[model samples]
Target chain A: MHIPFDQLKAEFKRVLLKLNFTHERADFCAQIFAENSRDGVYTHGLNRFPAFVQHIKNGLINIDAQPTLINNLGAIEQWDGNLAPGILNASFCMDRAITLAEQNGIGCVAIKNTNHWMHGGTYGWQAADAGFIGICITNSIANMVPWGGSTNALGNNPLIIALPRADGHVVLDMAISQYSKGKVLQYQSFEDELPFVGGYDGDGNLTKDPNAIIESKRLLPIGLWKGSALSMVLDMLVSALSLGKTVKQITDQGNESSASQVFIAIKPFNA
Target chain B: MHIPFDQLKAEFKRVLLKLNFTHERADFCAQIFAENSRDGVYTHGLNRFPAFVQHIKNGLINIDAQPTLINNLGAIEQWDGNLAPGILNASFCMDRAITLAEQNGIGCVAIKNTNHWMHGGTYGWQAADAGFIGICITNSIANMVPWGGSTNALGNNPLIIALPRADGHVVLDMAISQYSKGKVLQYQSFEDELPFVGGYDGDGNLTKDPNAIIESKRLLPIGLWKGSALSMVLDMLVSALSLGKTVKQITDQGNESSASQVFIAIKPFNA
Candidate 1:
């Protein structure tokens, strides 16, 4: 099932072109998808393409709309994503942050009304490749129970950090959940149990079985209480910084768009 | 056992006065230690006081040496701590970052030759109180086994992030280890097994027994491979940004002094 990276990218580009995407847009999106698979993130790669297309077709994603500046606060800028493609908006915001960093050594950009950006690592790598350290995080619809609670009331809230290095840039992309939804689905495909405790089963016992976890919908928070606190912190940060939708607001919307996100870029002097 | 918080603060002040510390200096240091415990971080509070004294007594800490500027790169400034008490140096650097953020909307300070910052939350609270978001991280001597390796070659680096809020400023203080050295000691003292799987025993099997983990010194990285990569990224960031000692260098020095640290402060616009 492993296809050559170039072939995978070409296939993606072919589909995008057939969907009437501009050639440049199709090429860029295809390359990113290929890079995700090449870098060993299969969940965000080919496996997720169908869901992405479905979202586009459902009017959940506004493929042609672009982000517009809503406000500017000195070194910080706020943007409305216009419900555009998440990947494009994220990349644009990070680009703005890098430009700000080049002028001021540090810059932060926050965006609202964006779709899922697929792998957060993509923007992290983009910043590092441009010779800057980067950090980004996004809130999602509630899929986790708050600490000391027994119901879903929190988001997995993925976080990404990358450091620029002469050698391979070090990047970390993590979720507050022990296993993300995509990861749990991947495990379910094999009917395999998680190697470590993942989530709760029926009747509230910790279980490694992906199906049981999905059935119960109580994903274990990473580091138990620590992850819950961290997720709250990130949620507060994105919401407060961007003045955008919080996890609860996103949940109320009934779909996963219009989430809050923050991107920060810092550059070395020599850069 | 669970003494009133004020009594603990007074006791810490008494001990510092007995060590010939000036009255004001003693009060500042004691208040920080007490606050750490008040915020439920007992490991860095009363329990760490004796070791702080030991460092002072051994002439390893320069009680009166102040941080001095090394370089300034626009929004970023570098300082040399002169081997001062870790808490004092950390507070001073955070104050500098706060000042910079107030003027520029963002500020980053990196310090070399600094001692441990005690509870990293102290600095986070400092920035949050100043109406700025705060982030601080410190590299330590290697105490973690890298991914896919049995030998310890990574620092259990601590990262702190805090945001100002109308209710309580949300703060997250985390070490990269699944169980920090302090928590392990706590478990050992309480004669209780870890509530969940923590580190690995000698045979690389995950175990909840504190004694087995401490004896093996093979503490699990938080989130296994995820934390290993995060640790490496943080180490590289602290070292590279400050041009100070890396975890490898700190370990080779045979002790955990003269570490590298970074503090960042960002001001937010009115929502």
Candidate 2:
């Protein structure tokens, strides 16, 4: 059950290379997936590798596609991800954001047409390692219900904030939902009820039963209306900034691809 | 009980002018307080006017002081609020942030020594009205307990996000607590238990009794550990960016006058 980090990474790289990824892309992605597992995020790491490869085989991820420049403002720029691998697009955007911050004290890069980035905290840690403040957000397919709504009309968007410190970086990565779908699935697999109310039951009342929540597809927001409104605004912020598809559009497209995201970096005066 | 908006603003202006506020400053502060009431936030409006004036009379808020530029880095700037009225300083900073964003597509302004800015959503609305995405955060005196800590060692720091829309703007202004101290006080005064568990009792168990929470002073964060970590990182961010005092320093100082805050504005690509 325990594999050496390098061995896991090498296996992932080998698979990716066979899937038509370039040597550099495979290595970068393998390292990210390996680190995600090392950090205990198995949901996005080894467990998710098969689905990731399936997306590639389905042509949902255009490995050969590159992000194209859209608009270049002094401190803010917009890009079109061109359906590229989320890991590569996100890495490139964060790099550009950091570079712009170096030149202008703060920088913002928004991209459209990106795929799922797997773990957003990767970019946050990236900026923190570079000695800058990082803030990023991404809108996903609808997996949550808006506050007071019975139907799923919101995405469990994740927000990341990171700051570099002398000892270690402080990073806060959070999702708008109280429980992620992965968490709900885990609870269901164990035939266990949630410790607290996770979502609504068939009667439209709060319930701890994961099966009911999963069937209803009404995952609760973290702070009720507070998280609901936060999710909506974050969606607007990312989608509008990138001039990309909103949650509604992405949901209508029937896949979680071509998402909008924003990456921001701020150069600390002295850190 | 149902004062007209202009009448309420005029009354606030009358009292502020009597406290030696300049005409412009008095008008601005009064309008903000009045709007707070108009928007149904009476806690920071007519009901909180006496405390606002008391801060001025106690020499905690220097009505004559103005925000001074500490450092400028093109798209980002640092400012010293000079113990000025929070409403004025916050407005000035947001205005500068918007102006800078207009020039560079994104801008960030961080300030120290600022007082309470009434409602954080005020600045969010200000930026949204100026056709920009606004994000702001401010550190306050410790009022909530940090995760795994029983003491009130974290500020219920508020985060604000706003986006411009063809319809009404979407704004989210939320503190890190499940229920703010002010809300708990309101519930206590009304002799009502919270609808949900608000905080811990003396025995360190979650309780809905407002009186018990008030006595224990262990207000719960919104998402438990999530909000605690968020409050800490936000504190670090505002303080580090502005070179201002942190929650620890503010709590030790025994007053909330000299607080740190950050305002960010980004030009949206399109509505």
Candidate 3:
């Protein structure tokens, strides 16, 4: 059965309000979730909503918490997310970055202690809609093996870049892995092999068998060593800029929380 | 056959000076070429020196041109490279970015009309040596096929990111292509199949045979569609920022010259 967009959003807002979200916050987040589905990112849209609510129930996300400024260095700023809802914090940070970029030509905001931002493209689109170039990245718990290593030692960090145009904005949102863990599980549920090599098996040989990769927990990074290095560098950049938890630190806690993120906005030449 | 670094640099300087370069310019360019070899990037080092000289001889590169500021907007600046040497222009831009970042915590410099910057890692190392995080990218003539397309439609743009540390810096220099055109040619010459799928053959099937890919001119982008989108976006970014030539325009000229590039530097939290 197909659900109407407004109805989906209204339902989400109702649930969030029941969970103590302010009306404005609830409406904004609900719209984003609805838009994610509208934009065809179902994995991060309705499919992830139940888990998101559970996280709030478990205190992994604090509904009323807001980001607090830590430091400001001209075009660069840092903040503590204070365990706030990732969507709200991400939106606020990008808004701040756009404001700073309006004055400085370019601005960067790094935040620590933020939860998952659901769909990173939301922020990219946010900046693009404001007529600016946007770039954002976030680190997650380790879920992929580094090149030439046997165990999982790297996070499939996601990167987003958006360019504004009169016709249509160009946005790219990608993780460093060839296939995300979710995608692998999806393929495994259907008992289908991946179209390309996705990871290594227990024998340390490359394979396209999703089940083998899942069982081994050895997801392959995109472009082999190149993506591995990129992932590590991105993790370092976010953690260093925010003075927040690293991927290793988050992984060591045995749960994903308090992740670091960076958002940058650049005023276009025409803008 | 072993040559000392100083001797090689001296030889290069002699040749450049004979071609009417100023003493200082000749010395600097010679040192970078020698350093490329010292760093084991033989393709951009001694192996590419003859072509470099030929480009100068052919008037494709100007020995006396320098970058001139076009616009300055606080933390971001745009410059015209005036067809200057890529190494010199890239270094100068990065230096300017570093200075701006020092004053503003983050800075970006974009330039158009630059020539080929051999071994982009040189600039990454330069930034890290000065205790800053550096990120840079340059657009090139179309050399790889975009995902799902049957012809060459994208540049194998290189991206470089560097992070500073107390003991050793981390630097990642990568081209978006799974294997560079030069690497494919090398494998063909060696009569060896690629260790992984490198590109598509004339029949549009993925293959590890370097010869087929070289003949078909269908070098694959890293991570398939992901890198293809990334390469396109990087091109758009550099061109839009500098108001310079796009990959299509550069390829239309049937030669690689007057490329666009961007350099960014950020002050780390500790710094």
Q: Who wins the TM-score comparison?
A: 3
Which tens-of-lDDT digit does each residue in B52-95 have in candidate 3? 99999989899999899999999999999999999999999999
In the order shown, the candidates' DockQ scores are 0.54, 0.77, 0.81
Residue lDDT tens for model 1, B1-271: 6788789889999998888888888888999999888877878987788889998888778877889998886777889989888999999989998888877778889998999889998999999998899999999988888879988789989989999877888788888887887888789889999987788788888899999888887777776776788788888888887888999999998888899999998887662
User: Each model's TM-score, in the order given?
Assistant: 0.93, 0.96, 0.97
**Candidate number with the higher lDDT (1 or 2):** 2
lDDT (C-alpha) at residue B174 in model 1: 86
Flag the better candidate by TM-score, 1 or 2.
Answer: 2
Question: What are the per-residue Cα lDDT tens digits for candidate 3 across A1-271?
Answer: 8999999999999999999999999999999999998888877889779989998999999999989999998999999999998999999999999998999999999999999998999999999999999999999999888988988889998999999988999999888899877778778878999998999899999999998998988888888888898899999999999999999999998878899999999998777
Model 2's alpha-carbon lDDT is: 0.90
Docking class of 1: medium
Q: How close is candidate 2 to the true structure, as a TM-score?
A: 0.96
Q: Which stretches of candidate 1 lie over 4 Å from their true place?
A: A1-7, A269-271, B1-11, B14-20, B201-205
lDDT of each: 0.86, 0.90, 0.92
True contacts kept of each: 0.51, 0.74, 0.74
Off by over 4 Å in 3: A188-192, A202-205, B185-192
- What's the TM-score of chain A alone for every prediction? 0.96, 0.96, 0.95
lDDT of 2 by residue, A190-211 (tens): 9999987888887789889999
Q: What's the DockQ of model 1?
A: 0.54
